[model samples]
Target: MTFVSFLRKNLQKEIFQVKGDKLIHVLPLAKIDKREAANYLCVSVSSTNDVYITLLNVMEEKTVLKCETRHNWLLKDLKLIDGIDQLQDNAEFCLHFDTKIFNLEAYSTASKYAFLRCLRKMSSKYLQYELQWIHFDQDFVGKSHSLLVPDDAVLSMQICLEAFTCACLCSCF
Candidate 1:
């Protein structure tokens, strides 16, 4: 996976591994906004404690297992990725958006065209990016490593670039 996607994958993996008390709370995620892609819109978020709990109803219903977290999921899965500093303070006017949460399946495969096209539709709606390039390696930082064509990694890179850009815009605006 590209470094960005690698970070995202690791971030996604970390979401499930979040220890007690450190868990990122669940919140309502909007699929779209009326704002332009270059800006991060400020919208109130509602807390959802039973967000994943609803999966109980779909399990016995059908093959709801397409892409999922390490723990398995249905309809949607939630992930939180962020730095500790962004949320170090909590008070009036505090923002819970220092970290980002991804709600996609744990696994997926799409080509560049299909991925970018898909992104244009439901994408974060929170971010946008002009993809540069992507390269993958077992250890991206290793000098002796060889880069491979990023199949899934490219899709994730697209997501992260867009999400990071969204976060920056939100904070600046």
Candidate 2:
């Protein structure tokens, strides 16, 4: 099966299970200003080992927002007021993406801790490599290394490596 289909099937099966109920909460982070209304924040792990956070409309049982922790995603704790006059009592943490941000609030302290632990655990599994380096050893020169390299330098190095790999492959044939 295609990856999308597999993900959807796994999400449907895991998100509706009895254990998934614990992850459901009325998160006030919804676009609607009605804090009293019930909205669901659901976190689930797909069969493919991907982590997903979904915001649901409890009344309609429909997803309002869904995010996967694969690309350009960050989870942070909203501890400080950061000059805001007041913060919501339930406002405990937030999930940040490249284009969107979700302020997450839990039903209780324990729930907040649990969610944080789960998110952190999942997020830590994916590591984005910022730079690549190649090492050469010789008798005259033991080893050489580059330090404090800029982003452009790293990109150039990666491009050079790719070009070298392509050249070697072409020469072999």
Candidate 3:
């Protein structure tokens, strides 16, 4: 059998597959450091070819790593969003790594939040930031008053608005 077929067949087995939620994120492994013993199976199978896998099982409270290399990081080490760019939100939100990491395209708003919720569960409490969308009853002087941002970010905006209001009131006299 071809390597592709062999991999497909093996991946279907229960040993390789774990039961849990669908992947919240699937970041690629830039460097796959494999043991010399791992090379015994086939000459064609190189460390570079193997796509390392990291499974985030939120319900089970574990992150499983099936990397090309033997060494793997547990949930605690992996889940902390300490890096400044660990999470990015634009048209889409991505967790961990800026480049070459897998894209988690959450089509619906609910799905996006579900994914974020799962991510928050996996992350450290301080590092976790919930995503929220804000909507005002009406636009402010025709300017759009709708926004979607992290919960922590809203605090600063609120403070700035309060300061602006106070300054305006003081100046009015």
Candidate 4:
């Protein structure tokens, strides 16, 4: 079977939308984080090559927030965690960018998986990166890490570490 066909059959290709009543937008310490309660939200991703994340106000049916990664490399990180917040009964996930972090909850675990898979597939395609799935120590963090790294990213990661180490050594001198 062709790779595209295999992916089409195995991967999630549907636009995923879920309704929830909470959202937390976090920025760096320099800025304040905002949280909303009892606000209905509809989060969805389009099933297109040019994928965009649309956050809607379900009550008013208005588009509240829309984000698109014009450059795939702009997406810094993506994580999926379960039962992180005892107060939230649904599955929670986070999308980390350079400037902001969006923590959103899916109505159910199934929906969360569907949304994540679709997002990951699009990201991998556009970013031209191989996704590395790393499961964290459940005992410690209870989180799973999904990293998009190009094949040569290992070298890049190593080089970045070396540069950091060198800077630290130079500072000691």
Candidate 5:
């Protein structure tokens, strides 16, 4: 079988694939045409290639990019990627991440303030992270987060992301 076919077949397994993520990457998806329900995303290849993958209607996903992408210890440069010259509003990004989780519950409010209060309750209270996205699943699913980020006590974004990460981590693991 061809390499792509092999990857596709393996990915189509009936049982849940126990894929271990030693490295992480991100994919940016955008909603362009509603009638066709078409979407476009830029996924990186091991931090080597950053190419654009287009979907005509969810099943017709094909890569039209010429570059590669990969995971990096530092923030990957978006300028290096070819297809991301411009960004659309409400673009959805998928970032691969492996992080610790304890608990993330809300009773009163779902705002950032309430979120941070719960995160600080963790025993490992100071884990850092970058803002990736919120995840919800049927089983063994909660908010998904990137790795704990570096220290930054100044920016408001840092405060919010860090808190949400901690809260989500507490609930997930």
Candidate 6:
């Protein structure tokens, strides 16, 4: 399997290892607003409490995984690659960039889908940036390793690039 897939599977397993505290917020549902989507969207984050968010740039060999004692992921810039339903009944989604990959999970399938929808809507509306931030990593420092691309991945990437180019050309008026 590709490194990204392997990391994704392992991370999914690790995320399930934790069953967070059962503390539900008591608030009324408000009208969905694009401006408020970024902050209002919430999900049950997984991984151990000790694991802090880490942003790594593999190609540049640069990282910004540490800043303060804790991080507010809602404030950072991120992109959701694969939406929810990658795994049935297991609220999980994948995020990636040119180098890094982030796996996030919610409590249930409903919450997972809801979070994914809100995130996609918000991102498309406001944060049109590429997926360059890494928000979930256990070993912050060592997580900056270079991405491994095998022969299959290279071929798949070529195929995808060709398809994308064709689509772009066809769409041009």
Per-candidate TM vs. native? 0.19, 0.37, 0.25, 0.36, 0.21, 0.29
Q: Write the per-residue lDDT of candidate 2 for residues 1-173, one digit (tens) a residue.
A: 85333434444555545334223221223334554344545555544444556665433226542433232211222222111112222335555454564555555433343344344444555322211111211111111144475323443465478789999999999
C-alpha local distance difference test of each model = 0.27, 0.39, 0.32, 0.37, 0.27, 0.35
lDDT of 1 by residue, 17-98 (tens): 4421112212112223334111111111113321121111011126322223222221122222111121222111111222
Q: Give candidate 5 regions above 4 Å deviation.
A: 1-26, 42-57, 60-146, 149-156, 159-173
What is the per-residue lDDT of model 4 for residues 19-60, given as tens digits with 9 covering 90 to 100? 221111111111122442222222223333333444432111
Q: Clashes in model 6: which pairs?
A: none
Q: How accurate is candidate 1 locally (lDDT)?
A: 0.27
* Candidate 2: segments with Cα more than 4 A from true spot: 1-37, 60-91, 125-173
TM-score of predicted structure 3: 0.25
lDDT of 5 at 94: 30
Overall local distance difference test of candidate 2: 0.39
Q: Write the per-residue lDDT of candidate 6 for residues 33-61, one digit (tens) a residue.
A: 53432111222233332211332211211
Worst 10 residues of 5 by lDDT: 77-86
Name the runs in model 3 displaced over 4 angstroms.
Answer: 1-91, 98-100, 125-173
* Cα lDDT tens digits for candidate 5, 42-73: 12122232222212123334742222222232
Spell out the clash pairs found in candidate 4. none
* TM-score, candidate number 4: 0.36
Count of residue pairs whose backbone atoms collide, per candidate = 1, 0, 0, 0, 22, 0
For candidate 1, give the lDDT of residue 39. 13
Tens-digit lDDT string for candidate 3 (1-173): 85424443443332234432122232211112433112111111112232223432211114432324233233333322221222333223333443333333333322243334334443423334432222211111122233575322343455478789999999999
lDDT comparison, 2 vs 3, better candidate: 2
